[model samples]
Target: MESMLFASIKPMLATVGDEPFDDEDFLFEPKWDGARMLLHKQGERIEAYTRSGRRVTDKFPELKEAALAIIAEQAVLDCEGVCMNGGRAVFDDFAYRLRLGDSRRIAAAARSHPASWIAFDVLATTREHLREPLHDRKRIVNECIEPSERLSPCAFLMGRGKALYDWTKEHRLEGIVAKRRYSGYQAGVVSADWIKVKHPVEIDAIILGYRMLPVFAFVIGLHFRTVRFKPVGLVEAGISAEQRAAFLGIVAGGLHAKQEGTTQWLKPALCCRIEYRDRSDWHELSGTTFKGFLPDKRVDDCMWTY
Candidate 1:
């Protein structure tokens, strides 16, 4: 039979309350700091698929080798390939490998910073497509992928709304994702079956100030409000001449540094998005920036949390 193709999408749930897992409701898993992929193995052949459904077996030879080495006769998996160094995920390091397309860099990356698989779902383990309820799929995944250094099961905190929320915050995990225990797997976008909660809301703020460095142009700050134009935090800006030029291009007539009252300030016109770890003390930022600016969003609508 031709290899089956599984949808690369899965529902990501939001946190409700910090509720504890009761025996009947839901299962939880660890959120991996890695790229998501679909793993397929049949006989001696193995392959990986990107989120866009592109075949990426050749791009991750190490992972392909792991799949082939599995003693299972045939299987399909939903997993993430995280490149870890000293127990921390290094997205930049993996990105560098992506930029270097040749086999040499691929081999070098494998040796210097290898990728580990975090198996979360089992699409197929026996000959049938387990399009059954998500709860069952998770159970089979746990049974199939044993805990090893290279392969570990994702742990989740399943419970009532408030308890799970508390656990998520206490653990400093991304946030608790609440899922309806009976939902079936749906291919495409995020399903209503799941929900997520992140602390320290993210927001879009205006660029208000910056600190210039010899290595870069400026560490940009953002404004929390336009009418009041309150200074929030700074984003590491102007990393390169080209970056400085780009930033200048984005902001009208570049930048001019001066002081406003007792505060050192830059023009509050440029906008940026930033994510924070918490919002308990949103009112004050004694000696810090608004958090970190996210380049993927607009300045006018910087994400914010209450």
Candidate 2:
């Protein structure tokens, strides 16, 4: 049979929320930390596309097998391509597999760190199901796909978002995504129909430098009374345009030291709040984002946790 090709549909995105709540109309699922992909399958032919429309079929042969295993004449699925390490999804492992261009290395990595497709939504089966309600489409996904080591339905809990979020946090999972039961899939839109609640580790850090190339980012450091200030990580997200302009002025005024390249060193006098998912093995903060400047927080008060 000739391979079938489907349009690359942009994956729907979720809006960020403060906390989780119990709602009869909502269903909660674990927000996996992995690449969002849409899988298209026809007979033995399979293809995968990322959120930005990048074709990644060659990178993950395991997921292709999983997609082909689905019992459908034609199907499209919304999923996360996850590589697990110690029972938790690891983005680094997934990225390692994604970046492999050579078939031999890709096969080797597949044997060592195989990826799985965690299906959460169904967009088509013989025909498009994009206009169907989420609850109905979810049923189609469960009915059409056979769960295996490389393919599994994303587990969900209804009307108990807070409890699910707490369980995710307790297990050190990334976060929880709550979606309206009756909401239809809106391609490329970051809709309020789905909201994400994260369990992030908060910290106070001192500003070490600033980078203004490509995008504005702050190089932050953890302060110790004995060791003074030590570099932790860089934060770029959550900084507003107004905040960026104001920070540029402040950095220019405090230019007492210099560093090579685009980084302009600043005196460890400014403090800010940062939130991150966790710390890497090198003690660097992972998924760091600026929360806000702490005008009342002194640099001496900045300390490292874990």
Candidate 3:
């Protein structure tokens, strides 16, 4: 069997928005909290790539095998490679498995924290389906892919987005994504045709310092427009080592002060999105987790919310 000619394409991105009303023109799907991957299969050969076009075929052998199991002559699928634990997608476990370079460790991780591909769109079959409407592409994906333990179609709810969002919140799922039924796939673009509404309390915070001990942690501060910055809390979750290194590099040379037994303070020029529960009366964030660095956001944009 020959391998498919793979093309590096950025998957379509979703815009953040409030949950929308249930409308017949849209379909809603659960937003899996995992790495975005594109799967390509031809005959008995299969390959996978990250949303950034990084080739990760060998990183997930089980998913590759699952892709090969797909019933198709040639195909390209937009999927999320999720590591589910107790019926919930765990991003940290999925990221850890994706970073394992050793075969033995990878095998062990696969046995312990196996990943699955939740296919959301069919970009191509024997022919390209890029210009097809979302509803048509969704139908094609449902018909072409053979379901297995490691692979399954992403289920969608039609004109019931509010109910789905309520269910997602009640079940502690990541969020709900709504896509316009008539919108065509547009690679590498953050389009309004699709919107994502998360179930967490999200806020923008300013970077203050970081700790390198026991484990890596980022100390962030809260700001209210022109108000002074105040230490809110520290977050040691949801960020990968690679992301930590990248963040350190971004804050390099911006150091302002350092406490011998505490943190290395920065200039507070960087902003990041944090997901957490309500802030305590003492102004400390509860159940905080690093979401991602917000490059487009500025320090002045960070606002404190109680």
Candidate 4:
């Protein structure tokens, strides 16, 4: 029983062009549209856990039902917990589901907006630990189960780097992840086995003030400052906790007057490389983080234009 517990680890990401390996040499998996879930079953009792170590079994009744119906013996599999509404992912549709504590609501939502387990990697089966080679474990999971209305394997494509990148863009998918064909699973943080090839999206923007979230510490903003930082956009995707701390320390007391409406203005001392999908004439825009500045990228580089 102890040997069957192979922990699944998160993948590490590489910058757009840093240490890029040949795509043909790596396995490419689709970036799923869901939350990371770990499934562990022992006898008649089954448990579903979130990546953050929280038990979410009650929140997803459909998954619970499917787990009981299909799984055999003791096994651990890494998958994405996806909620399907009208045959497509609504992205943030599961927000209410997580917070919902009522079992009746859970059942109703399970029937209305069902959840699917998109299996990506299998860590263990019975007493055998398949973590040593990803290719072997993937084959075990791929051949063991048949696709159903609620379960499917993650999509994969094999090609050169440029071809895969082009395919991601054509499908409007997030990006392709590159993983070594043979690498063991290592738990906690990002592991060395994986590298991501994502569309390079960047923009030069001035840092406005910061809005502090309770748990997230601080969130930065980007909008034209001449009329004051009137809530044009936010930065959430790329900036790390270390960068957030450093940025907050740099602009600690540079808050200007609340402009245009109720938004606050911050001193323009930072310029960051932001990635987004929308590129339009300025009035308002939506984007997330991609990468950030080097210590050498000076504040003089940030200037806004209409």
Candidate 5:
């Protein structure tokens, strides 16, 4: 059967919430640390993209099995591309996978470090379901995709976000996400209808610049107002000397870096995650520490918005 056209899509985003709360109108699920992906399948052809609309279909070729898992004529799935390590979802493993450029190496890594697409919502099947309530679309998700090792549905809990949040904390998972059961999907929008409560509230920041002199730190910033990179704070902890040397090597290998006084500024091309207590009003990350480099993420994806 020929595949019908689905509308251009972007993953819906979640607003940051202060804390987890139990409510009858919401459903909670794990806020996976894996890359946010949207898988589009048509007949035997499958394509995948990151949240910033970067095509990554070839990067994770194992995910092409979504075409087999999806029983619908055509489908659009909002999912997370997770890399597994020792039976646990490891973001670093997936980041390493994204760093590979050779197709043969990527294929080899697929077997060595297997990954899966964890579907959370279905936006289309035989027809578009953007207007359908989230709870209603859960049934459609079940109908559209058969759960398999390559692709599986994300299980959710109703009216117990705090419990799931506790579980994630105890297990050292990212956090828990709560979505309004009656809310419809809004592409590319960050709405309060879907809320994310993180364990320590991590933020993705652009590597605006770096200073290697007295402190050996990374100058992290966000693209708020978005005219230019807004300096937030320095990421001095959690990044080892080995990581620092590797990052500087990339800069030396013509990734574009220029000296600005004592700091070396680069073009907007690199990003890193930061674990912080809160975002200050003056655009600073309070009690900040380096989390990890984001290889699958776009530079502009590190925005200051909620």
Candidate 6:
């Protein structure tokens, strides 16, 4: 493993689990609603990359002080890049920051809508090849990284997943993650050692198509096995007028569009994050609501669960 090139490595992923449990082997924490990022700090230079390996360091300059937050010669930290609004993480604010290109605009936006890095695990400085257990690695994070307004440590409870899950659910927070105490970090790997349970429901799905006639709603679906998309149902609520226009312009490029009756079919190119009450069936999504566009996710990332 190349120690310094950790920016190229993908962040480890969590698999969806059925229910939360109180187990001594697992440490549970609130699952953040934002993009996954891996922060690399070597000497005076710090770099931030999305789970897909896209460099987003310049996009949120307010976090530039993050380079000095880590009190170490070299380190690679797994963090969640989040924007807060009214005490809750807001994906729309974070997405808006990620889409900017101009430095002046980005700098100005950073002040108006700032993002923070919440460190959960330390990989490189804890050990080479991530051989250390999660408990020890997290200890390194708590000690090495000094907390600031922009960078802070993630909080967790030992053997109390069910309690945290209930609280998050009651408050309508994102959800909770259960990580094995002795598990080692696995870059780019989605393992059972780490489990994610959402509050009610929220998952990534592909925009199979859309219909504009009676009302504007997205025909959303998820990837099932080898199938590209398994159409679930239409997501009608929570999409702002600005969001509607923005998504329409991008999919209308003629590069990923097809017409089937009144519905405009689209190639499996656009992905969105949505929250629904539940899956009434294999094809129906109850109380489906659009969260926002997840640029960090691919079509394959929207895997079906049934």
Best by lDDT: 2
Native-to-model Cα distance after best TM-score fit, residue 69 in candidate 6, in Å = 1.6
> What would the per-residue lDDT of candidate 3 be over residues 241-268, giving only the tens digit for each residue?
8899888787775555666576778777
Q: Rate the local accuracy (lDDT) of all candidates.
A: 0.55, 0.84, 0.82, 0.59, 0.82, 0.82
Q: Give me the displacement of residue 178 in model 5, in angstroms.
A: 0.6
Tens-place lDDT per residue, model 4, 1-306, is 464343333322322333234555567775554567777766656667777667777788776565654455666777777776544444345544666789998888887767778777776676554456877777777764567767767766554555666766676554566777777666554755677655544656556645554323223334444544343456666668788787767665654535433334565555666665432223344545537764565655543432
Best by TM-score: 2
Show model 3 residue runs off by greater than 4 Å: 1-4, 201-306
Deviating ranges (above 4 Å) for candidate 4? 3-21, 68-71, 85-88, 128-130, 159-161, 200-255, 258-306
For model 3, what is the alpha-carbon lDDT of residue 259? 62
Looking at model 6, residue 40 earns an lDDT score of: 85
What is residue 282's positional error in candidate 5, in angstroms? 22
TM-score to native of every candidate shown: 0.59, 0.74, 0.69, 0.63, 0.68, 0.69
- Candidate 6: global Cα-lDDT? 0.82
**What local lDDT score does residue 25 receive in model 4, on the 0 to 100 scale?**
57
Superior by TM-score: candidate 2 or candidate 4: 2
Of 4 and 5, the candidate ranking higher by TM-score: 5
Model 6 — TM-score against the truth?
0.69
Q: Compared with the true structure, what per-residue lDDT tens digits does model 6 show for residues 1-306?
A: 254454477878898876889999999989877778889877787888888898988897866687778887778889998888777776656767888999999989888988998999977864463778999988998887889878889999999999999988776667899999999988889999999877667788988899997889999988665566889889889999999999989886873667888888887788898987544313367668999998778787788643
Candidate 6 residue 300 C-alpha distance from true site, Å? 31
| Model 1, C-alpha of 231: deviation from truth (Å) | 18
TM-score result, candidate 3: 0.69
